[model samples]
Target: MLFGIILAYVSVGSVLIPLVLASFNWQNRSFEIRGLSILLLTSLICDASSMLLSRYHINTMPIVNFYLFAQFVILYLLFMRKLEIKNFLRVLLVLFCILCLIDISVFQGPYVLDTFSHIVGNLILMALSLYYFYTLLKELPTTYIHRLPFVWISFAALAYYSGNFFLFLLNNYLLKEAGSIAWMLHNGLNITKNVFFAIALWQAYHNRKLST
Candidate 1:
């Protein structure tokens, strides 16, 4: 419990650097950098709000649901610029929203935490991350992969979604149990994503200096 608490605290605080870096270079050419910054801010707000609400014995289910759609939209916009499949993504976005509404409104109710949306969202993001990787391999845009912001951000998405996919899958079941350890991995991966996002921001900053 102490360790989990520590991790949770770290996880919440971890986004500051990346979020600052992202905002520092807000007018960036790459949508990925700007999108990631927005995503991190969204995450910080949601996580911090959820924690505060939970402390007050308030239901945080609404926040969880909102964050689900928010990240999806953010990622969709990011991909809309990066990928060549805007039309398909538009249809997919509409369909996904419709399905999630049904999943929340009728099937599970808004207060109950639903895993179906989580499962599906992670899969969609993971697939998109993989496709981004495929483009990287095909295009070979930069010789120094370490300095590529997009590459780092893409991998960060892949790592976060893939690492937590199963955790979200099992969340409904494990959540019912007392003292479940599933959250450890969730917090750990959250930290990993934050660190990676900061690295991506640094790479973008470094690339900016190089160009200037």
Candidate 2:
């Protein structure tokens, strides 16, 4: 838990720096930057809340639940808009939300973390990230691949989610059996995710500057 907290602070820095940068250039805020800003802010709050609740020996599942669902929506919007798959993705998002609600209400209560949703949602996100990469490859020239914000974000999402998929799948079991190891792994992966987001945001900032 201590390790998790420390990593959370570092991750928050990754998000916070870009957020501060974006704030100063309000006139140049692109949709991707705005979406990332919202995601990073929400993640910071959720991480802090989860840590505080854990410190108090309170149930932190609700915060986890909210973050998982909200992150999916935010990322979905980011990718859907970028991919121009809004109509189809919107339907899928709504259905996924309903299914998730049902799963939470029936199988997974608010007091307990929902690994099922995490696994399924992460799989979908990973697929979306891959699709984004495919689109980027097909649409962008080789020279521009490294500079595109989507490239960094997609790679980050793919790497983070793929690495954590099984960990999240077994989170509840591990939290009880190997609590220390569980938190360490979770926090470490999260830090990676945040760093990647920071990189993507920085690239977006540069992209915006070039456009202006």
Alpha-carbon local distance difference test for all models = 0.83, 0.77
Give the Å shift of residue 74 in candidate 1.
Answer: 0.7
In candidate 2, residue 93 scores what lDDT? 86
TM-score of every prediction relative to native: 0.91, 0.86
Across 57-160, the per-residue lDDT of candidate 2 in tens digits comes to 99888898899789888888888888867788889888888888888999977887777777888898999999888877687655867677767777778887
Model 1 vs. true fold: TM: 0.91
Q: Which one is best on lDDT?
A: 1
Tens digit of per-residue lDDT, candidate 1, span 179-199: 247777888888998888899
Q: Tell me the RMSD of model 1 versus the true structure.
A: 2.1
Superposed model 1: Cα runs more than 4 Å off: 27-30, 170-179
